[model samples]
Target: MPLPVPDRLCDLPYAHLLTPHTGPLRSDERYDTVHFDGGEYTDQRAGGATFLECAFTGVALSGVKLRQARFNEVWAQAGRWVGCDLSESEWQDSAVTGGVLAGVSAHGSALRRTVFRGCKLEAVNLRAAVLRDVVFEDCLLRDVDFGDARLTDVSFPGTTLEEVRLRGARLSRADLRGAVSLGLPDGHQGLQGAVISSTQLLELAPQFAHALGITVKD
Candidate 1:
C-alpha cells in the first residue's frame, strides 16, 4: 500500500548522522513549497518519503537511503548525493540539475517527465528502472549501470558516457543524437529510433565504415 503523505517537514538531525537503520526513517513525510539550500546530511535513512513542489538547492547528502519515495514537481538544483540508496522511488515532473550523484543506487525506480541536466553521475546503479519522457543533457556518466532499464521517449543531448553499461535495456525509442560514448554491448548501441538529419549521417558514415570494416570505392 502507498504510504500517506506527511503534513509537515521533519526536523533533521545535526550530529552523529551515519547509523544504518532497518526500517524507513522519515517515512510518509510531505513538503509543499519548502526550500532547503546549502544543507548537508550524512548517513541518514529516509524511505517512503514524499515531496511535493519542493526545492532542494545546494544540499549535499551522503550514505542516505531513500526507498519507495515519491517526488512530484520537485526541483533539486546544484545538490550532491554520494553513496545514497534510492531504490523503488517514484519521480514525476521533477528536475534535477547541476548535481553530482556518485555511488548511488536507484534500482527499480520510475521517472516520468524528469530532467537531469549538467549532472555528474559516477558508479550509479539504475537497474530495472523505468524512464519516460526523461532528458539527460550535458551530463557526465562514468561506470554507471542501466541494466534491464525501461527507456521510452528518452533523450540525451551532449552527454558523455564513459565505461557505462546499458545491457538489456530497452531503448527502441530513445534518442541519443549528441551523446558521446565508445560503444555498447552486443552491437546494439547508438540511436535506434532517433531522428537525425542527413548531414549528420553523412558525416558519420566514414566512422561507421571504419568500425564495420566496410571498404568504400570511389
Candidate 2:
C-alpha cells in the first residue's frame, strides 16, 4: 500500500498520524517518521518532535523549526536545509550525504555518530553544541562557528575551512587531512591533534620558523 502524501497540517489531527503506519496524509501536514522522499517542507514549525528512522532524500526544508527534537538513524541525502533552527536537538547515527545546510542554526544541539559527507555547510552556527564521532568528509564549511563546542573524534578530510572559527573548541584526536584554511593566526594554533600531510608541513615550515624567530640558514 502506498503511503498517503500530506498536503496540510490541518488535515491530520496530530503530527504522528502522518507516519507510514497510520492512514493517508495531506500534502502540507507536519509528520514524524513520514516517508518524505523528494518533497519540500517550507516555513513549517515542527518543534519537539521525534523522527525515527526517517529517510529524506532530495528534499528541501526551509525556515523550519525543529527545536528539542530527536532524529535517530535518519538518512537525508541530497537534501537542503536553509534557515532552519534545530537548536537543542539530537541527531544520533544520522547520515546526511551530499546535502546543503545554509544559515542553519543548531546551537546547543547534539550530533553523535553523524556522518555528513560531501555536504556544503555555509554560515551554519553550531555554537556550544556537542559533537562526538562526527565525520565531515569532502565538505565545504565557510564561516562556520564551533566556538566553545565540544568535539571528540571529529574528522574532516578533504574539506575547506576558510574563515571557520574553532576558538576554544577541544579537537583532541581530530583528523583534518587535506583541509585548506586562511585567516588563521598560525598553523599550530588551528591544528591541534589534527593529521597533516608532509607536504603541508613543508609548506608551513617557513611560517612556523618565522613565528619562532629562527632563521633557516642553508
RMSD of each: 8.0, 8.0
Off by over 4 Å in 1: 1-25, 182-218
- Candidate 2, residues 37-89: lDDT per residue as tens digits? 66777787778777776667688889888888888767677889999998898
Candidates in order have lDDT scores of 0.73, 0.73
Model 1 TM-score (2 dp): 0.76
As for model 1, its CA RMSD to the true structure in angstroms is 8.0
* Cα shift from native, residue 60, model 1 (Å): 0.5
Per-model tally of clashing residue pairs: 0, 8
Q: Using alpha carbons, what is the TM-score of model 2? A: 0.76
Residue 185 in candidate 1, Cα distance off native in Å: 5.3
List of clashing residue pairs for candidate 2: 6-26, 6-27, 6-28, 7-26, 7-27, 7-28, 8-28, 8-29
User: Where is model 1 poorest over a 10-residue stretch in terms of lDDT?
Assistant: 11-20
